[model samples]
Target: MKILVTGANGYLGQGIVEELSQKSNVEVIATGRKVDRINVDVKKIPVDLFEVKDPYNYFGRPDVLLHLAWRDGFIHNSPAHIDDLPKHYSFLKK
Candidate 1:
């Protein structure tokens, strides 16, 4: 099964990608704004998730999409979260 993970360079994302990479039946595609931090051996794609029109097709038509990408997640009141809401919604809508 093909699985595409967004924000794959984040703390949680890195751990998830590492675990998924060990699965023999799983094909992991790691994507993020910066993928250099991901230590796992997998197909890493550095992209702006908000700009993706068709995520499934854009990321090789993965069977599953793990949307972990977010900005200023640690800041409870970060304006970026609300600012990017539309982009996130639009990306998911497609």
Candidate 2:
């Protein structure tokens, strides 16, 4: 099965992608703003999720999508989180 994982370069994302990539039946598609930081041996795509028109097709029509991408996650009251709400919604809508 093909699985598309966004935020694949982040701390949690990296571990998830690494674990998923080890599965023999799983085809992992790792996506992030900086995919070079991802250490897993899988398909890597550098993408700005907020700007992608069609995420499903853009990331290669995967059977599943694990949307872990977020900005300013450590900042509890970051304005970026609020600013990106609409973008995140739009990305998920498609």
Candidate 3:
């Protein structure tokens, strides 16, 4: 299956991608706000989630998406400032 993994440049994200990539018949698409400096075999992409209406559209019809991103910090980190988690998740669930 084609897996679109967000925050794939982060520590946890990178690890997941690395481990999953070695398995046969699995395609890993890694995306983050910024690219990882280190070299890796997985597909890498840079995207800002907030700017996207439907974030998954960027993946070109992914079969699955491993959500590894959360908007955090004092800058913008609350339900009041962002979309409802359940609703946002539901949107992606489609």
Q: Judged by lDDT, which candidate is best?
A: 1
Estimate the TM-score of every prediction.
0.94, 0.93, 0.71
Which stretches of model 3 miss by more than 4 angstroms?
72-94
When sorted by TM-score, best at the front, the candidate numbers are 1, 2, 3
Which residue window of length 10 is worst by lDDT in model 1? 49-58
Quick one: how many clashes does candidate 2 have? 0
Error of 1 at 70 (Å): 0.4
Candidate 1 C-alpha lDDT tens digits along 1-94: 9999988999889999999999999999999899999887899999998777778789998988888888987788999989988888887777
Clash pairs, candidate 2, are none
On TM-score, the candidate that comes out on top is: 1
Q: Who is ahead in TM-score, 2 or 3?
A: 2
lDDT tens digits by residue: candidate 3, 1-94: 8988877777677788888888888888888787674256878878776556666676777888888765552346476336546544664665
Q: Which stretches of candidate 1 lie over 4 Å from their true place?
A: none
Global CA lDDT computed for model 1: 0.90
